[model samples]
Target: MLETIRGLLEGKPGDAPAVLAPERETLDYASLRDLCDRTVERLNALGIGRGDRVAIVLPNGPEMATAFVAMASAATTAPLNPAYREEEFAFYISDLGARALVVAEGMETPALAVARRHGARVLRLRVPAGAPAGWFELEPEEGGGAPRAARPGPAEAEDVALVLHTSGTTSRPKIVPLLHRNIVASTRHIGEALALSPADRVLNVMPLFHIHGLVAAVASSLAAGGSIFATPGFDAIRFFRWLDESRASWYTAVPTMHQAVLARAARNPEIVERRRLRLIRSSSASLPPQVMRELEATFGCPVIESYGMTEAAHQMTSNPLPPRPRKPGSVGVPAGPLVRIADPSGRFLPAGEEGEVAISGPNVTPGYESHPKANAEAFFEAEGRRWFRTGDQGRFDADGYLTITGRIKEIINRGGEKVSPLEVDNVLMEHPAVRQVVTFALPHPKLGEEVAAAVVLADGAEVNEHELRRFAAERLADFKVPRKFVFVTEIPKGATGKLQRLGLAQRLGLVE
Candidate 1:
C-alpha cells in the first residue's frame, strides 16, 4: 500500500485522469505527480518542509484538492473552511502555529489579515485559465524570506500529513494530527472496501477540508489509480448536470446532500439514466434508512452507508458491495479498524450489547495532538491493546452489523431512563407527514433532561406537536416520546451539514 500521498500516483498510467474541475482541463496522473513535485520544490524554496504546518484556504474545487495532496506530501496540511469568519480564521491560524498560509491569487479572504496578525507568510496561488486543473504557481508575498527548514523530500510514514480540528459542537475544538501511515492505511482500506479501480470515476461534491472528501474521495481514488471529478461544492440544482456530463461511476455525499438530490430526482430522468452509478456512498453523518431505500430505488444501485470521523482518518466501517449481505440501518461491519464494544471503564462487551464503540487499528490516529487529558479519556489500555473510544454509542448484531444508536453525550436521560435519539428519529421518520427530523434533549427542571425534537414537514404535509407526539406515543414508550416538539422548516446543521444534537436546545431558544 502507498504510505504517503505522493506514492498514491505510483505505477499509474500517466494519461489517466486524476483530478477534474467542472469545464476545466483534466490533470492526468503523470501531470498530477509532476505538479506535486513542482509544488513541493516551491514549498521547499519558500522554507516549508515536513513537520512544518501550512494552512490552506481556497475555494472548493480542483485547486483545493490538488493543493491538499501536494502540500501534504512535504508539509503538514491544515485546510481551513473558506467560509470561516475573521475570528475563526485568527483562532485556527494561531492555534495551528502555522508557518505559512496559501490562498488563491485574487482571494481576498479575512484569513489573509489573520495570517498577518500571526506573522504567517502569505503566498498567492496563480492558476492560468488554460492550464490543467492541478497546475498552479506559488507566489510569495512581495519581498519575504520565510523561516527555513532542512527537510525537503517525501515524508515517511510517521510524519504528520494532516491536522484538523474537531467540530467541537459541545466544547472547545481539539487539534488532531494524522500521520502519513494513518491516512494511507485509511485510503487503501476505503478503496478496497469500495472495490475501486482505474475504470471507476468518483464525483466529489463534498468540501475539500473535511475528512470525508480528503480520505474517502480524493485519496482513495488516487490510491486506486481512478479519477475524481471535483465539483465546486454540493449544489442540488447543478448536481444532476455534473453527474451526467462527468459520467461518474459513483459518488459520495452526506445525508443532507443525498436528501436534497433525492428531492430533485423525479424531475431529472435523462440525467439519471445517462449516468448509472455503480454505487452510492453516504457518510460523515448517519444516513436515514428511508432516504437510503429511496436512493436505491431511484438509482438502481446499492447505497453503502459508512461510518467515519475526523480522528479515524475518514473511514471506520462500510457496507460491503454486492454478494455480501447489506443490512439497512447498520453502518456495516468494520472495514479497516478492529471495532469492539466497551463499557465506560473499558471492559469489552459481548455481541447484542449496547456500549461505546472502540477501535484499534493503523487507520486510527495515535492520539489527539498534545492533549493529555483528552488522550487519557479518549484512549484506554484494554486487553493488551490501546483502544480509542469513538464517543458513539452502538452495538454489534449477531450477524456482526454495527448499528450506531447515538452519541454518548447526546443520549437523552429522562428521569434516569436512557433514550436513544436515533431510535426516536427512526420512528418519527416513518410518519408520512415528517420529512426531516432531529431528536435532541431539552433541559428539564425536575428530570434534568427531557426528550425533544425539531422537525421539517414534507411539502404540503402538515403536522403539529400534538399529532407528532401521538404518532410517537404509539410506537414508543411514554418516556421516549418527545416532551417538546418544535415544528421548524429546517433544522440547524454544522459546518459539514451534520445535525448537531448537542447545544441545539440553547440555539433554538428553548433553554436559557
Candidate 2:
C-alpha cells in the first residue's frame, strides 16, 4: 500500500516506462523519480516548497500529467483548466492563494496575466527538444518575491497534495484539499479494482485538471508500475488512431467520450480488433445503461462503471472486474471507502431505501478548506465515525449494489411528486433514435417544475416528440415522463464533458 507520493514512484522498476505520448519518447520510472526530486529542490530554491500552492495551467498531455505528479510530491498542486477566461483565472488564483503559476513554454493563456496581478510567481515549463515525454524544467519569470519558504522538502503523507474547487453549479465554488494519504489510498483502490500491473498501459483522454484524470488515470497507473499514454485532450475523431499507436490494455473516461468513440468505432474496425482492450472504466458522471451496453458490444470487453468525486479524491465505489457481477445501472460496491445511504439527519438508511449517499474512509478528505459553514453541512458524525455526504440520492439493492438515482439538487419536484431526471433519461435512452438525452426541470406555472428532455438523435435516425414520449411513458410513471422534448445536434457538456442538469433548462432556453 502506497502511503505517500514519493513511495508511489520508489517501488517501481527504474527502467520501466512511466509515461508515454503519441510519437514521443517514453518517460521511465527512474527518470520520473529523479524529476520529482529535482522539482522539489528547484521549488525549494524558488521559495515554493511543501504546503505552498502551485497553480498549473497547461494543455492536457504528458507535460501536464508529469508536472502534476512531480509538483504534488514537492508542494501542494492546484491544476486549473487552461480554457478559463481571465476573470475565472483571477478568481481561482486569488482564492487558492497560489504561491506560483506554471505554464508550458510558448503557451498562451490568461493565467499569465492573472498570476502577475495576483502577486504569484510565474514559472514557464520548458520541455527540451527530443526529450522524453513528461521531462521538463521550470524557469521562474522576472517578478515575484525572493527565494524563501517555511517548509522546504518533499511532502509527507499528511501534507496537502492537491487542491480543487467544486463545480459550484448552485453556489460559489468551495475549496477541497486532498492530503497525500487521500490520493495514495485512492490510487491503491483504483489499481486494485482494475487489477493493474506493470504490463498494463492506459490510454488517458480525460482532462488533466480533473480528478478522474489525475488520480484514476495518471497516479493509479504509475503507482501500479504501469504506463499511461497521455493525449492532448479528448478528440473523438482521433481516438482510434491513438489507441492503435499506444496499444493500451484499457482506458478510462466519462460516458460522453465512450459514446463518441462508439460513434466512430465502425470506421476503424481493424484498430479496434488489433487493440482488444482488457476493460473500459467510466466515472465522473452516471454511465447510462444504454451506453454501457453499446460500449461492451463494440469493444468486446467488460464496461466497469465507477462512482467518484473531488471530495473523495476520485474513486469511492466501482464495479469489480471479472468473476464478480457488474451491474449495469449500479455504480457497484464500495471500492475504496465505506459507502452507505443516510437519511436527512445522517442516520443510516436500510437497503432498498433511497437517501443521500455518504462515505467514510482514508480516501475521504478531512473537510472543505476554510469554509466552516459549508463543512458543517457537508459532513456529519455518525456511528462513531465522521462521514461526508455526497449530495447524491441513491439506494442499495438486497445484493448491496448501489444505484444512484440523481443528484440531490438536480431532482425535479413536479408540484409535490419528486422525479429523478436520471430515471427519465434512462427510459428515453431506450429509444433507438435517441443518441443522448439530458432530462431536466423546466419551470411550469402550475406544477412549479415540469420534466423536459433534450434529445440528440442517432445518425440518420428520426423520432418526433410524441413518439419518444410514448416510448418513455411505457416504462416510466406518467409524472416522471418528459412532457417537453427538444431535439438538438449535441447537448452542451461541462468542461469535464459531463451534462449539467442543474442549469440545463436556462442553458437550453427552456426556462422563461
Candidate 3:
C-alpha cells in the first residue's frame, strides 16, 4: 500500500519535481522520501503505532501532506480542519477515539482545549509564518535524544489508513474509515482515467482534509509517479503564476473554485500562452453546463466533470480525457465499477431512468465506522454483491453518461409536485445579475413545503425579488419557481466546501 507513495519518491523522472508548495521550497523525489522517513521516525518516537488514531487538525500545504504520509506509515490518520469550533472538535475527537492530536505551535483555537480535555497527547510543531498552516518544522528532541526506530514494513491492504468525519449538515457527523486497499484502488483508478504519468504535473489547490484532495489529487499523483504543486489555498493570482512556474499539466477543484478562476481568466492570458493546461477537473459539487463552457473557452481545455463521494473513496465516473466525447452536463460513464440507478424499493432501474444511484466496487467502503443503522440503510445485497445506495437522483443517457439531477433529500415537495432545486438553480444562475444561487424547500402550512431560493448578486449588481422570480418563472413551471427569494452576499458552505441545502432554510430564518 505504501509502495505507491514510496515509488513516487524514488523512480520519477530525474528532472521532475515531486512537490511544489505555494511558498518556501520545493522537494524532489529523494528529498520527499527522506522527509517522510524522518517524519515517520518522529511520529514513532511519540508512541504512535499501527491501529492507533492520530488526529491531525491542520490546513492545506506540505506539512499536512508530510504528516499524512508519516502517520499512514505507522497508524490511522484523521485529518480535520483547524477552523472547526470547540464543540465540533470535541465531537469529532471523541467519535474517532483519537489517541493523539497534532497542533501547530500557538494555535489558540478551541481544538487545543478540546484535545487537552480529552486527555489526548498534544504535539506542537512549529510552522513558519509564510509556510502552510498544518506544516511545521519538527525540531529534534532537546539534548539530542536517542533516534526513534524505523516503522514496520509495508502495511497490509485491509489495514485502516484513514478515519474521517463526514460533513454533517443535517445530522451528527459519522466516522468513515477507509482501508489502504480502498485508497490504492481508488487512486489507481483515478490515475488511469486521467492517464497520469511521471512526466505529468498537477496544480492542486483543494484542501488536503477532503477526500478529493487526498485521493484524487495527491494520492493519484503519487501512485502514478507524477508531480504535484500543492497550494496553501485557492488564490487566483498565485494559481495562474504557479501554473506557468510549475509547468502544471492539469488541475482539479470544485465548481466554486472554477468559477473564481474563470472570473480572473481575463486578467491572466499570458500564463495560458506560456504553459497550456492539458485538462481541468471538477467535482464535490455539480458543475453547471454554462460554467463548464465558459471554463473550457477561457482555458482552451476540456473540463472533465466527475461523480464521486467520500464513501466511494473519490472518483466513480469521470469524463474521459480525450478521443472520447466530453459531455457538457453529464459526468460520463462508469470508470472503475458497476454503477446502477435503483428505485426507492431497491430495485435496479433501467438506463435513462431517474432514480437513486447505487454502486458496487472494490474502491467503495465496507460501511460507516460503528454505525450499524447507517450500514443497514445504506447498503443492500444485489445480485450477490453489496451495493451502496447514494442518496442522489440521476439517470444515464443513451451513451451511458450519468447526469446527476439532484439529491433525493434536497428535492422540494410543493404540495404533491416534486421540484428539483438544482434544475431551478441552474436556470436562475443564467441571469447576468445572479452570481451564486441555492434553491431549497421551506416549511409551509398550506403547501407542506414551498420552493425557496437564496441568491448572491455579482459585484455592483442588483436584482429585486420580483425580477428574480419573473426570471425563474420564464424557464420553470409555477411550482418549480421559487415562492420566496432571499438575497445574500454569500452562501454558507460545509467543511468540505460544498454548499449545503438540507438546513439552509432553518439557518436563514426562512423556516421555523
lDDT of each: 0.91, 0.93, 0.80
lDDT of 3: 0.80
lDDT of 2 by residue, 78-133 (tens): 99999999999999999999999999988889999999888889999999899999
lDDT of 2: 0.93
- Report the lDDT tens digits of candidate 3 across residue range 1-512: 44334433555554456677755566666666665666666666665566778888876776777677656766788999888888888998888888778876666668777878887777776766654322345542233344343334434577787887777765678888888778888888898888988878888888888889888888788778887787776787677887877788899999888877887878888887778888999998888888898988888888899989889988889899888999977888898878999997889988878999899998888799888999999999989899999888999988899988898888888999999888988899899898788999899999899999989888789889999899988998888999899999778877656777888998898766
Let me know the TM-score candidate 2 reaches against the reference structure.
0.99
In model 2, the Cα lDDT at residue 424 comes to 86
Q: Which ranking of candidates, highest TM-score first?
A: 2, 1, 3
For candidate 1, write residues 250-297 as lDDT tens digits: 999999899999989999988898789999999988888898999999
> Considering summed lDDT, which 10 consecutive residues are worst modelled in model 1?
141-150
C-alpha lDDT of residue 165 in model 1: 98
Q: Model 2, residue 37: displacement in angstroms?
A: 0.5
Q: Residue 501 CA error for candidate 2 (Å)?
A: 1.0
